[model samples]
Target: MKEKLIQRYSASERINHWIVAVCFVLLAVSGLAFFYPAFFWLTGIFGTPQLARILHPFIGVVMFLGFFIQFFRYWHHNILNREDVKWMKSVKEVLKGNEVGDIGRYNGGQKGMFWVMTLCLLALIGSGIIAWRPYFAIHFPIPVIRIALLVHSASAVALIASIIVHVYAALWVKGTIRAMVEGVVTHAWAKKHHPKWYREMTSKK
Candidate 1:
């Protein structure tokens, strides 16, 4: 028997999600403005190239901190389990649009994505601190600063790609956007997508 679930995300979670999302958009636009001449026009969106350069790191800091909040909240649920390994083995089926029976709370893909984002956040933050100019960079060695720049740019590119995939997955799955926006998922939607999670949430301890 299917039954509705209570709130899966609180108001704080939604707020944090949006904060990270907005920061991501800002950083993406500004970062791209400097990445290529074609995207140089993007700086106009923020004001000027000088201003975009000034704002990118600050925006990245805010986005990463927001991600940290979400990371702590969901970390426990994202731990890998035997079920996740099994789900990984059947990933091809999942891509083919077949629902692997007994899909767990997050499945392997979501778990992998969570860890990927977490690692990327750490890399971005660490390298960002090293490369930040007119401040910390003055104290750091030139070689260290150069390496930090490389790592920061590489991590940013990888993070952006991961987020694109994440967004695509959210949109690909029907009812997913509503879950993030409204903090609720219908019982049927939950069961069909994450049977193990649905059962666990609804079951008596």
Candidate 2:
């Protein structure tokens, strides 16, 4: 039987999600422009190299703040349980597409992504503050500023990689994007992809 689930995401939640997504895309492109000379052409999209340099840090800060809101909203649900640890141990079964029945609300991969992104954001924010030119760096020691530069670059790389995996997972799971876009999943989708969550939601009423 097909059943409609009540809205899981409010209008505010959807707005926040898209805000973060757009900022992320901008940050990724601008960051890449500065990261590689070969990708220098990308800066033209934002105007010039000088403008890209000026805007990158500001864009990064906005994206990180947006991500912080999402992290808080979903952190409770994404917590790792014993089942998640077992799912990680049996990840091979997941790769073979045979462990759908055993997966929980998030599964191990999603939990791992959540944690990794959290750590990366912390690193980026900290390093960015220390390395902020024309502001914070003027008071800090040069050595500290240099270290912060390295940390910022490393964290950005990790975050970009993590987001790539995040995007891939969303696309890999059918109906996943629709859940985010429309803010609701069908009962069949909930039951098939997150049986425990489905049962809990249904049992509540």
Q: What lDDT tens digits, residue by residue, belong to model 1 across residues 26-144? A: 98888778877998999987787888888888988899889999999999989988778887898888888777767666778888999999998899889988888987889899999
The candidate maximizing lDDT is 1
Candidate 2 regions with alpha-carbon error over 4 angstroms: 1-6, 100-104
C-alpha lDDT score of every prediction, in listed order? 0.86, 0.82
RMSD of each: 2.2, 1.9
lDDT (10s digit) by residue, model 2, range 155-198: 88998988999899888877788777888878877777677888
> Best candidate per TM-score, number?
1
Local error of candidate 2 at residue 49 (angstroms): 1.8
Q: Which residue pairs clash in candidate 1?
A: none
